[model samples]
Target: MRIGDYKVSYGADEAVFRTGTVRVWMIVLFLAMAVFPFWAGDYLLYMANLTGIAIVAAVGLNILTGAAGQISLGHAAFVGIGAYTSAILITKLGLPFIICLPLSGLSAALFGVIVGAPSMRMKGLYLCIATLAAQVIFEYLFKNWESLTGGIRGINVPAPTIFGFEFNNEFRFYFITVPVVIIVVTAARNLFRTRVGRAFIAIRDRDFSAQLMGINLFRYKLYAFALSSFLAGVAGCLWVNFIKIVTPEHFPLHESIRYLAMIIVGGLGSVLGSIFGAIFMTIIPEVLKSMLNIVSAFSPDAMAYLSPLQTVVFGLLIVVFLVFEPHGLAEMWRRVKDYFRLWPFEH
Candidate 1:
């Protein structure tokens, strides 16, 4: 079979199960995830939780920026809204964590719709500036809204409970988070096949042309924003519960940048890229810290220099990846796999 410029073999034309290898890999991956919490230690489990949360947020950002071609400097703000809303509901309103979590996401979605309304008339840097303004406004609200957000003091988030079972430890949280990550990623993957998703892609490729083709740019853009915010909110809610805190410091502007970096470094517009990007970005710091610790063990005097070196290394990694491998780690992985699979048969 052939589609567009690519040739498709017997298994490649299938919509869901494209190939036997993919199906097997999916099953193996699912099995590994199911058993990971039981075997992993506290530190690994903690990292997994962080990766899961990042994946969710990155997926949302990919939908907005990758599929819709909207630049959002306020992605973290929606996450903050989700966290703060859930925290307040749990701490003040005495609601169940599960109930409040979804509500928090809903609240963020509503706010996203409001923010996106202005985006209908804005484009390019102007739209980015608008989103940045919302981010600043949200930060101010989180900092000054003492009655709800607890001001700069922050608020404690209780451990999540599902049907009387509490996810109080890293292991338990890992189980909860991993499944949610899988579900969210799968949903995001399938979304791109739907009409709204196609509209988003169309708008992304050429908004004016998409509009000329009868696509409702305003409605679809608003939908994209709401969907993106909802996912971000869900991630934020999970993060708050995972960390057991809701602080303004947690949703800093740098975090928004980090999320963008995750998508860019993972592969924009790809679900697999989002997941891999989250995992790589989240774990790389820990890996670096371990390496630094080992170096310090050999020379205690070098400990103070490690932090700066780590920062420099991280920046360099980003720059190098952008300049040489802008398609990101996933793309690199794909190319490497293809090279090996085809062996001496060069395309």
Candidate 2:
């Protein structure tokens, strides 16, 4: 809200951009994003694309676990399904990447329903275990299905082209991801405003209570799973296209845990938090690697400890956030904004 902004009507009170200032800022932000490719280096562009993909996946996980209060450790498997589905269709069936992207998401959503079937009878830790087991089963299938997935060999994806324009470099490809991310993020931000989104939140808060209020526990639970998995699937499709390769080993349990850590660190129930978490999780390793390289160069003995040190730093970052800031970085961000807004005020 602007400093002197006031809602004159109910619609104004509920609007996304309540003030003209925020909308102007948003326009400026998009304008800057539009020109980022021209000014940024290849590495920065790569990170931007990578972060965008992770944001998509993190937001999906946040929807299931954060908004719906459903625990899923099998999220990576859904993403893997998306990647493989898109890759197989593109490679084997000669389908365009654009068409395969949503189709891949739908494929994963189908599996999401199957996996969510256990949710009707399970909750909390039991449900977490069920999803965790699903990951194992999914991974086994990914690894064992040698013919389709290429097994340990992996499959390559050709660079996508649209209307005679090839997205061969990160700069050009940023157009594809930036728009998709914007759309996904915008949809996610608006989703909670709708009845179905409210139903998901109600189920998350207390499924039994939600059921008493006429919300179908089974149906909404599966809906949450399908929606969440579809987002993850889209992320997976983006990953395969960006990386230009699909491997069974790419989606592992640690990756799933990493996405969970991201949402938790970013703030579970916030859309912006997903983007924050994805950026932090993706960039930190690169930051740690850079620091470690300097240390290892000065002392070769430190080379042996590089991997474990980075792991320790990552674990510590999560532990610090969980222990002292359970609400995550989004809460921290709000406090900063509040402080700025209330500057010069007296207690």
TM-score of each: 0.93, 0.97
Model 2 alpha-carbon miss at residue 326, Å:
0.8
Give the per-residue Cα lDDT of candidate 1 at 135. Answer: 92
Tens-digit per-residue lDDT, 207-287, candidate 1: 999999999999999999999999999998899989999889888887888888888888877878888888888888777
Assess candidate 1 and give its TM-score to the true structure: 0.93
Backbone clashes counted, model 2: 0
Model 2, 273-324: lDDT tens digits are 9989999999998887788789888897776776798789879988999999
Each model's lDDT comes to 0.87, 0.91
Best by lDDT: 2
How badly does each model clash, as a count of residue pairs? 0, 0
Residue pairs of candidate 1 with colliding backbone atoms: none
Write down the worst ten-residue block by lDDT for model 1.
1-10
**Which regions of candidate 2 fall more than 4 Å away from where they truly are?**
none
